[model samples]
Each structure stands twice: as structure tokens, then as C-alpha cells.
Target: MNGQVMKKLLKIAVVAAFSFQSAIVSAKLEMIDRVVALVDSDVVLASELVRRTNSVLQQIKSRNQTAPPLDKLQAQILDRLILESLQMQMAKRVGVRVSDTELDSAITRIAEQNNLSIEQFRKSIEEEGTSWAIFREDIRAEIMVSRARGGSVSRRIKISDKEVDNLLVQIDNEGLSRVQYSLGHILLPLPEGASPEEITKIRDKADKLIRELRNGANFQEYAITYSAGQNALNGGNLGWRNASQLPTLFSGSVKNMKVGDISEPLRSGSGLHILHLIDSKGGFETHSVIQTHVRHILISPNAITDEKAAFDKLKLIRQRIVDGEKFEDLAIEFSDDKGSGSLGGDLKWSDPGTFVPEFTKAMEALAVNEMSEPVKTEFGWHLIEVLGRRNQDQTEEKKRERAYRILHNRKFEEEAQIWLQELKEQAYIKIIDEN
Candidate 1:
């Protein structure tokens, strides 16, 4: 669907069925397409369905995966197109749009993600058969669908504090403090009738064994040769055990020991034991995640202020931010997203999922204290800044945040299907049989 010819073909067909009359078009041109399906006030043309089906087939082939029967794939893709058409209609009804600035930013992100310059990405797309013009419209459609989906779905999915608290309780009861360890043990046992002198001999032997293991002596080899523990035959290899499952004495000692470190003699009533720190897992350190502290000046276009004016205003705001004007003051004075604007545009410390995809991407790419050029979204333009960032420990704040997300996601999937089903049930949809 990407080459120059298809690009021209698709561009023509995509634009209101290229909106030319088929009789007139056929009179002048050779190619003709028919409606495959009729959506509420729109049609899914045969050309568009074939184009998408081929794209899916090409993707499957590229991945070396077996393609499904053509009939089945077409049905699925046709259903998908029907849904998109429904959503696009909704978008038009609501005045949701993909502005040129927003489209350009999205394309830039796509190019960057592919590790290609804009020119190269364009060249690659055209070479592959999709014209840049058609490609842009496709991206615009994608963005619109996303906005539509979010607008429809987000309101239905809400996570309560009570839900988060209950989940955290469940997680806590399931042992949040446990860490697992794989260890090697060597036991120098005391003879049953051993005197104090005999105990000293075992302790010294344990100390000596630890020194040897520390200085590159093979711990498993030593365990098999000199240890009297039950696992001594298996090179004293204590396969993975949680902290609570470990020997009372070895449990506390292993927590502070680094992997590969052989402990000093852990004197249990039965013997003087030596432990090797083989490996550990599932500690709090693993919960570290980066969170961004970000803020922005948001401005929206209205009848009085066009998209250009909105964008131009944000550009000046960003430049002032770069040149040392306080972002908070400017945001308070100028931002149209008044709720956050009153707070100096401070969205506060947040994960990337806090905002729309475009905002998330722009925020993720900024450094601490750095400002971004105006970025576009459905809401309009924004001049964003990364106030600071941190690899925060997963404290209570993080746990609840994650719990909220888990509950929200679980409900979202269930609700989104219901929402879409309702959309279908409520919509005017008719499929034209090829037969």
C-alpha cells in the first residue's frame, strides 16, 4: 500500500472516495472501486479494505508467521474498519480533529522511534509504496481514533481508594518483605561428647574453610569433601529458599552478604556452619521506577484565537521559559487549562501514563529543568518543562498508584468491550456482500 502508484491511488480513493463520480472518474481514469460496506453516513470502499488486508498480510509474512485464510482476515479487517468509521463519525460530530501541528509532531515521534531522520522516514515510506500524503492522513486517523477511544472509555473506568487499599492489603498479606536466596552451606559438626576444646577445633576449621572459599577455593568442592550437613553430598547446594525458609542463623547473615561472599562461622547448636551467598532476588530495590515532575502552559484555540495563534503564543511562552521567565507565573497568567493553570501548570510528580500519549512522549524526552518547544495535542498546544525527575523507591505512594492502575486496567478492558458493543448496537451498519 506504500509505493508511489498506490500512494496516488489511495490518496485519490481516500479523499471522499477521491469524491469524484465513478462514471466521470472511469471516463478519465482506468481504476474503479466500489463500496464494500456502508457505515452510518460513510462507506468502506473495496479499495480501502483490500489495501488494509494486504498490509496485514505483508506484516504477517515479514514476521514469518502463517497468514490466516484471506476470507477470515478480510472479515476481521472489515469489522475493524467499520468500528473506525463509526468512531471517525463520532469524532466529526464532536469536532475532534488532528491539527497539522499535532500531526507533524506525531510523525516526528514516529520517525524518531524508528531511529530515522524525517527525510529518511519519508523516503522509506515512499519507497515501500505509501505516499507521504496518504501516510499522513492515515496517522491522522489513528490519532483521532485514540482520542475518540479515550474520550469514550476513560469516563467509564474509575479506580477507587477503597479498591487500592484492598489490593495493597492483599499484596501485603502475601509477603511483601520476603527475599529469596540460593545458597551453599558447609557444616563442621561438633562430636556429640565434644569438650570446649573440641568446639574450638570445629570453629577454627569453619573459619579456615570460609577463608579458603573467599580466596577463590571452590565452595562446592570443599562442601562435598569436608562438610557433614545433609546436603553435603549435593555440594551443600541449598536450592532457592526464601528468607523465612532459611536456617534461623543463616537467614539474617545472608541478607547483608553479597553474592559470592562466604560467611564467617554461623554457630548453630548443631554445628559451626559456613554459608555461601550464591544469589538473591525479589527485593525492594527492584521496585525502583523513574517518575517525572513536569509542568506546562496549556493554550487552546477558540473562535477568537486560531490554531496558529495558540501555537505561536505557546512558542513565545516556551522561549520566555527558556530565557528565565518563571513558568509558573506565565502559566497562571496565560494557560487556558485553567484548573492546572492556576497551579502554575504543575501536573505534579507523575508517571508517563498520567497524560495523553503525545504529552507522555514529549515529557519522557526532556531532561531535568529543561523546557520543550510547543507540543500539540487534541486539547491544543502546550509548552512543557521537566521540573525534575527521580528514580523513586516504591513507597506507599507508588504501591497505591500501581494498585489503582491494575484495578483500572482490569475494569477498562471489560468496559471498553461493552462500550464498543454498545456503539455497534446503536449504529447503522450494513455490509455489502461480494456475492
Candidate 2:
């Protein structure tokens, strides 16, 4: 054969090999970025699902938590991705966004919390086999989801004053008000306006679940397999919340159950729940609540008696009281407060904010059964007596404020779960199985 012909054949062979190698590389990229799930107008890529699954697995390991099956974990991660895509789409529609500056600040704050610099944080993330770019995307996505969630869930939470007061009553009775419970929950959601038959069926399922959970069945696995709660993917972890912070339905069950004890199926507005008390920490917490039983003898300055006469009358009245004269008698005869005077000037037990600022200060300063000097209030010249002081009284304002927060959080949790379920039910989703 001619040398030219041999060289030409060799060059053609080399070109064909290079083309085949490029084709292999292209296939690899396609496999990595292939669509695993379609969520509304968005797609979750294979690479994303893999990354998220690995991250979750690592987190579970770090926390010493038992993970569910790989297939279950993957499905959970894919569902999460689909939900996140839906949220991001909603965020875009509503103009909810995290600016680059805000995102940077969030990242900086995370790093600071972890006691690391940005560069150090980047290195740490990369060391865990995640790219820095992907981590930023994760952070951005998290912020967008949070904003979207707040917009959707905040409106659903309506804490009525009566509801708050009810919660306060519960809190007051709760001996473990500040004790935190780390719970695992499995929700068996009922259909809207479910029939009695349906309710009984769900209750049976919940009861079975509680039995299994208490009898050494893997809670995380059961949760991933059956739970309808939003945190089902995270092994139904509701994380940590104090008794007051727990949902009203849950708080009652939790206080009596010991750690690792699973509650019998409990029903709420949403559905039946099987609760696993993963852990508990903390003890009783109480606020200093001081109440003073006070009585005031008010002598108003009238046209007949000038301010000086009123003041002098109060002084004389106070002197008479200090000289062992009957306060009730003086209050009835001279006190302008017709109602209180009739009751021996008995104001009963008063909370801190019950009185005017001046009156409250004077009352607060007086010891039990101690008489105050003639103090001038908006009412008139006053002779005040601290009949008794008690610390067990509830501060209505603070207690109500705490109750409001607890109710809001409970509402938020319940609402978010329902909202997510509705979102998935409403959206167009398609999962492309790897198989």
C-alpha cells in the first residue's frame, strides 16, 4: 500500500475516535442534568435530587438519626424539590425575592453563626463535596421559600383575644410550661367534612401507628411511608417546642407522656396524630407576678373644699389611720369614691398595670399593710393602703402576649401543612422515574 494511503486511513481513524469520546462526554452531561420531576413551569434536575439527598443523608448521620430507605429518601427529596419549585414560581409571581445583598447578608450571618469567615464557610461546604455555587443557590431558594411561606401562612393565622386567653389558662395550668419536647409526628389526615366511618377508619390507622411506634418500629421510616404532615420528609420531626408553644391538641398529651412514649391517636382540626416524644428537656419556668391588694381613700377637691383642704384632709385621715383609727370608718365617711368607700375602700387584688402610672408607683412602693403618704392622683388626694401582696397572680398582659405567640405558631404549623398539601394537589406535577 502507498504511504499516503496509510497516513490518510490513520488520520480518519483518529478523527472517528475523537468524535466517539465527545459523544460519551455529551451523554454524561445529559445524564447529570436530566429532568427528574416537573413542577408547574419548573423542572427538578437529576443532579439537584442527588445533591439534596446526599446532603440530607449527611445531616441525618451528623445528628445520629436513623434514616429511612434510600428509595424513600430519594422520593422525599424529589417531593421537596417539586414543592420548592412551586414556591419559587409563586415567589416570582408575587415579586417576592431575596436581593443579592440580602442573600449575601444571610450567608454572612450563617457563617458568623457557625464561627467561620465566608471563605472558610465556602471551604467547609466544599469539603462536604458540595460546590460553593450550589450552596448559594440553596440559600437563595431557602429564602424564597420562607418568604413565600410567610405570605401564604400568615394570613391564615387569626389569634382572637378569647383564643389567647384560653391559651393563657392552659399555660397557667401547665406545670411544664417551658419544658421543651422534641417530637416525631405522623399525621393521618381526614378528608374535608369526613364522615363518621372515615373518622373511625383514620382513628384505627392512627392507633395502629402509635402501637407500632411504641413497639420499636422505626418512626422515621413509618413517617416517611405514611405521614401527611409537612415535615414527613424530615422524619416527621416537629423539632423542639415548649408545652405552651405546642399545638393545643398536642400540649395536653405531651405533659403526661414520658420521653420515648408514643401518645395514643389524638385528633385535631386537621386530623388524627400519633406523637412520638423523641426527647424532652428543661423544667418549670415562671415569671415574677406580684399583685398588691390595695385600698385608696380619695378626697376630691370641690368648690367647697379647695386643693389645700383636700390635701389636709388626706393628711389628717392618714394620721388617724396610723394612730390605730379604723380606716374603713374614715373611708366610708370621707372617701369621695362612693363605690370603694361602701366596700371599706377595698380595691381587691390589683395587677401592676391596673392603676394609673402614679397610683401604681405609690402602691408598688408600699409594704404589705403599709400606708402611703397623701399622694395626689388624677382622681384626687389619696390615702393608700397595701392590704396584702401576692406573687402567684398572673400578669394578664404578658400571659396574653405569650398565648398569642403560641397560638400563632400553632396556627402557622397547621396552616403550612394544609397549604403545602393543597399546593401539591393543585399544581401540575410529573415525576420521571429513574427506573
Candidate 3:
């Protein structure tokens, strides 16, 4: 009987052990099921979504403002997640990849900006209830998006002489000195994962700072305390730049205004720019000239299969030009350059320094209606033609306009927005929740 009792006791102990193991297994399975959404190959856990929502709420709270309604906030978060997923997908499609080292360096820069050691910064984020893994992923996603967008936009964008000429007209009207203001800026950047609402709140704060500056507050003091940009320590002074050097958007606003003037808040890639005109000199005399329309045929060895083949192909095209086909017609048929190919390879001109040296030299050497032999540049080979040329004098109004043109052309945010929207429309996107 005692032996029978010992066997029964052993069985009971075994059953208890099995029950404990089963509980652990069940708990893990439950955690896995808590994923609220899946973006392509990535999963967004319910916990993670909630954590981010709470983070945004905290930001709102810190500013002593009420959070948006729960439903509204949730919708915004969902949209943001979808956009981020789409950006990541597009980045991969474009073959733009960020390395681990790049991610680490970005994080280090952030930490340094915040006046913390890397370890300390990591700890601080952890204390705020965010893991290093999430932060690194966020940084990587942003960098990838920026790089891909920049590549796509830059391919199609150009600075034309007509644009420069228009700018010159504005400068003449303003009668402002063609001065290069030595300027510096200190920026206080927002977090990479900040939501639209958060961005708006940040902008409001920036506007307030701008107001204080306009009221005679010290620029450097405010920058040191609140600016998020790397140049914040230097008081937001961008070093010496001509009127042409200032972006077109800011140029017009600052034109006709004297030194010591601070601009109204202007938005940029990272954040708002509140420019202070440090000093101006050399509103020098200027000249204007009618731009020429030129067409060319480009032969690219890089695009061809072999060096001999590329050279031979270019030689054939050169022979055809020598034999008497219009260069424009040939450019339309065979040039590798896409920007001017459809327009008969016509590059409208104003300034001299715009084209590559070889292309420029070829153009400068040619008379109107003259076609050159195959000329080589880093991009490949080219046959250039000068369609026409005319001249005019430069004026202050022209200078101001030119400055404005430069600003308008370099508005990175506008370009980025247009590119992103195009990518989104072209992509295959399905929101599981909506479906």
C-alpha cells in the first residue's frame, strides 16, 4: 500500500510541472496575437501602437494642451504608419539602403546635440518607455525616405538662365545692394517620428520665438536654450553669401530691408528658419543677356555595353551630323540625356558656369548654327549646337529677382512633398483595416 501511495504522489508532481509549462506557452502565444497591424513584412504590436499614441499625448500635455479625441488620434497614427510603410517599400524599390553604421552615426549626432553621451541618451529614451530598437528603426526609415526622394527629384530639376534673368529683374526693382550676408543659424529639430499635430505645435512655438526676436530678444540666447539645429550654438548665423546665395524665398522678404532685420519664420527641411541679416556689402553693378537655345546629342559609354561599341556609336552619330542631319533631330532620336532630349536637346542659357567644362567649352567655341565634333564629359560624349545668343545689362531689380529664384528652386520640402505623393500614387497600397 505504501508503494502504491509513492507512485500516486510522483504522478501528481509531474502533472503540476506540465501545467506550469503549459501556462508559459499560452502566455507567449497570447502576446504574439496582440499585433494590431501588419505592414508588408513588418508587424505593429498593439502595445507599440498604444505606446506611440501615449507619447504624442504626453507631448501635447507638456505644452498644457488637451489631446485630440481618441478616435482622431488613432486615425492619424494609422495613416502615419501606412505612409512610413510605403516610404520603406519605395526606398527598397529604388535600391536605396541605409547601413547600420549610418544609423549609429545618426543616433550619435542626436545624442551629442542633446548634450548627452550615447549611453546616457539611450538610457533617457528607455526611461521614457521607448526601446533603442524602435528609435533606430525610426531613424533608418527617415534617412531612407530622404535619400530616395532627393534622388528622384534631383533627376528632373534644373536651374535655368531664364529663371536667373527673372530674378535679376526683381533685384533691380528692390534697389537693394547686391550684398552677401554672412549668416548663421541654430536649429532645434523635432523628433523623426513626430506626428503632424506635434509638428504644428512645434511650429507654433517657433513662431513665438520669432515674435520675441522681432521684439528685440537676443538671438543667440534663445538659440542656445531652444534651437534644435547643429548651428544653434553659433546663433544661427549662416556665413558670407551673396544675394544669390540666399534662397529665393527669403531673398525677396529681406530685400529692401536694412541690416539687423530678422525675417519672419520660414519653413525648411528640418524646421523653421528665422533669418537675421548680419551685414551687407557690394550691391555691385550687374549685367543681363538674352539666353541661347542650344541642342545636343549625348553619347554615354556607361550606358553602352562596351567601350569600343560606345566610341563607334558616337562616331557614327558624329558622322551623321557632319553629313548634314539637323543636330536637334538627331538628339531627339538618340541622345541619352532625358531632360533635354524631347525638347530637341535645347539647353536654354544665361550664365557661363552652368554646363560641364567640356560641353561649355564646345559651346563657347562654336558660332550660331555650328555643330561640334564629339566632346566628352564625365557624363559621356556630347555634340553641341548654339541655336542663338543675345546680351543685356544687369540691374538691382534683376539681382533681387535672381535671389528669389534661387530660394524658390532650392525649397527642398516642396520638392520632397511632390515626390512622395507621386510615389504613393504609383505604389500598390491596401490598408487591411479599410478593406
lDDT of 2 by residue, 367-387 (tens): 887888988888888889999
Cα lDDT computed for each candidate against the true fold = 0.77, 0.82, 0.66
Q: Tell me the lDDT of candidate 3.
A: 0.66
- Model 3: per-residue Cα lDDT at residue 124: 91
Best lDDT among the predictions, by candidate number: 2
Q: Give candidate 2 misplaced runs (Cα > 4 Å).
A: 1-21, 24-30, 188-208, 224-226, 268-271, 283-396
lDDT of 2 at 313: 84
TM-score per candidate: 0.48, 0.65, 0.42
Better of 2 and 3 by lDDT: 2
Estimate, for each residue in 212-258, the C-alpha lDDT of model 3 and write its tens digit: 88898777556544654434434445577665555555666666557
Model 3 ranges off by over 4 Å: 1-48, 168-411
Give the worst 10-residue stretch by lDDT in candidate 1: 1-10
Q: Select the stronger candidate by lDDT from 1 and 3.
A: 1
